[model samples]
Target chain A: MTGSAQPRQPEAGVRYDVFHTDCPARDVVDHVTSRWGVWVLISLRSNDLRFYELRESIQGISEKMLAQTLRALVQDGLVWREVEPATPPQVTYGLTEFGRDIGEPLTELFDRITQRLSPRNAG
Target chain B: MTGSAQPRQPEAGVRYDVFHTDCPARDVVDHVTSRWGVWVLISLRSNDLRFYELRESIQGISEKMLAQTLRALVQDGLVWREVEPATPPQVTYGLTEFGRDIGEPLTELFDRITQRLSPRNAG
Candidate 1:
């Protein structure tokens, strides 16, 4: 077989083939876009927030659910957790560079969707 | 209340406040980014496909789930379902202008996430 006829290797660092079930990117997408995940990311867009602050800002999210969502984002490297050394330890969550890179687009999308569905536009 | 001090009325067409549970745009976001919804939108980004074709393209999606996802997107005005008058009554689905508008960004985000999660980049 000619060199040109050989099958090309899957491009490196591109794991987003939706057709492939084993693609790790699918999990990332699921996590970031999950019910609570979207809210968490958007909440952090403007500023870093403490855990309670996040819960307060995102109405209706349970403490357990918020914790789980934050953990998932942290694992995905999209969020950073900072712990303050104090009598009562404090933790604040902020988007990492990677998180911001993705979060910006998501926030824009969220805004657009909301704009489209508003009462004035619901014709 | 002074004229300048008056609270401005909610702008004409803006519906995406995640903080409010009754916000219509939240439902739009949920449906579009849902487990199967994301795949369906991404799949149709390049080309329109029939029901069966969509089922095949998005691995692991059940007929019930696909139907539900398509229905939600259609209701949200992001997907167009066209039925062909043929022996078997072919049905195809494609993105509406609105769908494309949102799909473009979603697809971009999906690509970015996949790129970041690929094994080669998994440092």
Candidate 2:
């Protein structure tokens, strides 16, 4: 895990180190835990959604930020974008298997934070 | 959960809404999940550490960012800061009960992401 500068070798039992500046995990962590990323993942955990539906569910996110966050998640392969062929083609977003794996913990984290900060729990 | 502009009343069981712009939970989420905050929490989860020790453990964090993140965490009551009276004095940071509660989920999230992004798992 120390200074080998070569690409990660998972087959050799090398672990991806997030503390390393060049690790790909850093990028994934940034995208997944990002402001909009957290909410988007949480929203999609229960159901797939259209762009506008996600926007409405998230309350105050701007359309641009939502679009950007979705794109990033899709690129990272944590989200899948499906386009249906129809008169008015439909575009929907859902978490991929990997996305769901990551999303579960994030959802739990969100619930915990919300619970801790809830009015009843606030001290 | 809909448009109520009044300050939160915890005794009434009103959950703090992260989706709402004015919710205090939103602020806490922004601080705790901020780029540096996640790593900081994960680093401190195993054991308490001094400011310099944290910076060292986290690899690439800047001094200003670390200081800011710690201050925000402390303000949110998730982290406890203890200063010992010595020749130069010593300051150590550790998770408060609430901080550990949140940190566990975050640590899980981090491990999951790292495992997913590892070269062996990357697809």
Candidate 3:
């Protein structure tokens, strides 16, 4: 692994090193793996959800934080937002194709933790 | 989805809910996905690494944080610590069988982000 903090060149336009420190990919990981990011993505599943539905799904999350999490996911291109014209404009969020690609692996990782390796069983 | 904040019972001694907020699995997720946890696990990459080697591989991490991170992994059973009987009792850290199970999916999720979903390409 290279030690330099310079931005890494993508491998055939296909990869970046998260270890490089200067890679934008590292930033993306940091954001997605943030405290609420994974929860939001995994909570989304295959269905688009209104903000309140998402808030209710992931208990103890404040509306401010939920909105922030959705915003970051959208900016990462892993999620999309839509506004429904109703009595009150309803904003909904769902995983984009790219989101599902990454979310698939994230879900797998989560299952590994909650299923096979948590303290109760792995011990 | 259950909105109750009670500790979730594992399914057939194998599953726990991370979204329930009261599940121990949630705390584990919060720890493992912290700024350095995923990096450390992915950095191990099927090899035993001396403390300094790990620090070197992951640029910009301080010794205190690395030590703390290793301690957590060791306690979680995802990493094992070995003291090589030597002049200074050299130490090494490596993943346990369980760590490998979880690390596999984490690495896949990471690869998805860097390889297929980074802004430069996902756009």
Q: Model 1: per-residue lDDT, tens digit, A23-82?
A: 667778889889889899989999999999999998789999999999999999999999
The sequence of per-residue lDDT tens digits that candidate 3 reaches over residues A1-123 is: 545553544454333568877776787798789878888999888588899999998868999998888888898888999998998999989998888988888888888887764544544
Error of 2 at B75 (Å): 0.6
Off by over 4 Å in 3: A1-15, A117-123, B1-15, B117-123
Q: After superposition, how far is residue A30 of candidate 1 from its true place, in Å?
A: 0.8
lDDT of 2 by residue, B26-117 (tens): 88888878888888888899999999999998878999999999999999988999999987899899999989999988989988988777
Q: Candidate 1 on B68-120: residue-level lDDT in tens?
A: 99999999999999999999999999999889989877977887787676555
Candidate number of the best DockQ:
2
Q: What is the C-alpha lDDT profile of model 3 across B1-123, one tens digit per residue?
A: 444443443453433568887776777787778888888999997688999999998877899999998988888888899998999889999999878888888988888887764545544
Give the Cα lDDT of each candidate.
Answer: 0.83, 0.85, 0.81
Sort the predicted structures by lDDT, highest score first. 2, 1, 3
Q: Which predicted model would earn the best lDDT? A: 2
**Candidate 2 Cα outliers beyond 4 Å, as residue runs:** A1-15, A85-89, B1-15
A13-32 per-residue lDDT for model 2 (tens digits): 43467877777788899898
